[model samples]
Target: MGTLVTGYVVLTAYLVEPDGPWDQQAVTNSKVAGAIGLVFSALMALLTMAFVRAGWLRKWWHAIPAALAITALLRLTLLAAEL
Candidate 1:
């Protein structure tokens, strides 16, 4: 779950062009990246829930990843608005 979240962060950092001019292609790329990030966040949430259910992780530990996923989704939403 951590790996998925980290990979999503890195992928967005690479794919999102916050400083660059928003060309048509760049907007398209950003949209695609946002969609992918949403999927990644969902997957992370599911995996975290699974871990808690399977007793591999404590209930309190679920908050960490849930917070990260929420933040990631918020960031992606803001980026999409910008594009």
Candidate 2:
């Protein structure tokens, strides 16, 4: 769930301005959105970790969502830098 949400947020940031209207302001807006998405992804990952520690998520594979969220956040960071 967290991975899906992070993917959607990152995709939205990527698709913000697909055309030639990518001015400085547009880039700044996209960066801001990406930053927010990164923060959200981080929080979701942390929450997933907490759940796992609390025994709510018993399986070892339950950590995969947090790992995927972190990966998405890393990619989003690179994308924001490129923007």
Candidate 3:
């Protein structure tokens, strides 16, 4: 889930709106959305693995939905901030 969402964001950022962080960005120096999304996904994968190894989760796959929710929350936050 996280991979899918982040992939979309990165694709959009790279192809649709290279100059913006989000779909509606005017302009900013923040890292490109694609890079940010990739970084977030990578970090989440590591964290998920850590959790799974710690006996906190049965499968790393289970982290996808949880990460999706968090990504959604961040998306909403960016949208609201844009407004």
Candidate 4:
């Protein structure tokens, strides 16, 4: 889920850049955002797995909302920036 969110955000940011602004800062921002998301997702996934193994969070459903929200926000933010 986190991987999906990070990929969506990174891909959208890349696609939009070619269609519009070609600024270095925009590229840097995208890279930074993607990197941060990747790191966060890695951490969260690890923690979630650990929790599940410990008999705490037993379902993947717990992470669904956050993943969906991140994906939606990534798309919206890209559209807004393009606009």
Candidate 5:
């Protein structure tokens, strides 16, 4: 999941700038968005693994929905920017 999200961000960023930096502003925005997605996904994966190992399955299960919501929100934000 983390990899998929990050890959999408990277791919989008590259596509958004196929030939060098189209504009500093666009590149900056893409980098920021990619960083946010990368950080959130990495943190969620780490927390999930830790929760599972610590026998917090119930809580982790509850958190999954929120994590997914954020993921969707992020995707929407990225797509919206492209448009």
Candidate 6:
């Protein structure tokens, strides 16, 4: 969840490029890195969630943070895209 949250924030920020905007190459590089981070984070999140559900883990509270992370990700992505 932490990874996801961080990934999402970082990815969104890269896309948003609020720091005086961004060049095409810079945006492309950032997107590549961000995509990798988001993919890994998503995989970890799903695995951990599955473990928790299957009684292999005991951290239910983590789900709350994951949910928040997803919400923030969605909001930031939407805002960045101006949609």
Candidate maximizing lDDT: 2
Each model's TM-score? 0.62, 0.60, 0.41, 0.49, 0.40, 0.46
Residue 31 accuracy (lDDT) in model 5? 58
Candidate 1 per-residue C-alpha lDDT over 1-83 given as tens digits, one digit per residue, 9 for 90 to 100: 46565556636644666455556676566666656655666666688789889999888866655665565566556545353
Q: After superposition, how far is residue 60 of candidate 3 from its true place, in Å?
A: 4.1
User: What ranking of all candidate models by TM-score puts the best one first?
Assistant: 1, 2, 4, 6, 3, 5
Q: Model 2 residue 72 lDDT?
A: 47
RMSD of each: 3.2, 3.5, 9.3, 7.3, 8.4, 4.9
Mind giving the per-residue lDDT tens digits that candidate 2 earns over 29-69? 66665766677677776777788798887667456555555
* Candidate 5 local lDDT, 1-83, one digit each (tens): 65456556545644554234345666566656655665665666677777778897655453553555465455445543341
Error of 4 at 45 (Å): 0.6
| Stronger candidate by TM-score (2 vs 4) | 2
Candidate 5 lDDT score relative to the true structure: 0.56
Give the per-residue lDDT of model 3 (tens digit) for 1-83.
Answer: 55676656644543432233454543221235645665757766777778789998779565674565455345434632231
Q: On TM-score, who's better, 1 or 6?
A: 1
Which lDDT values do the candidates have, in the order given?
0.62, 0.63, 0.53, 0.56, 0.56, 0.55
- Candidate 1: segments with Cα more than 4 A from true spot: 5-15, 18-22, 81-83
**Which pairs clash in model 1?**
none
lDDT of 4 at 27: 55
Looking at candidate 4, the ten consecutive residues that score lowest on lDDT are 74-83
| Candidate 4 residue 72 C-alpha distance from true site, Å | 12
| Pairs of residues at least 3 apart in sequence or in different chains that clash in candidate 4 | none
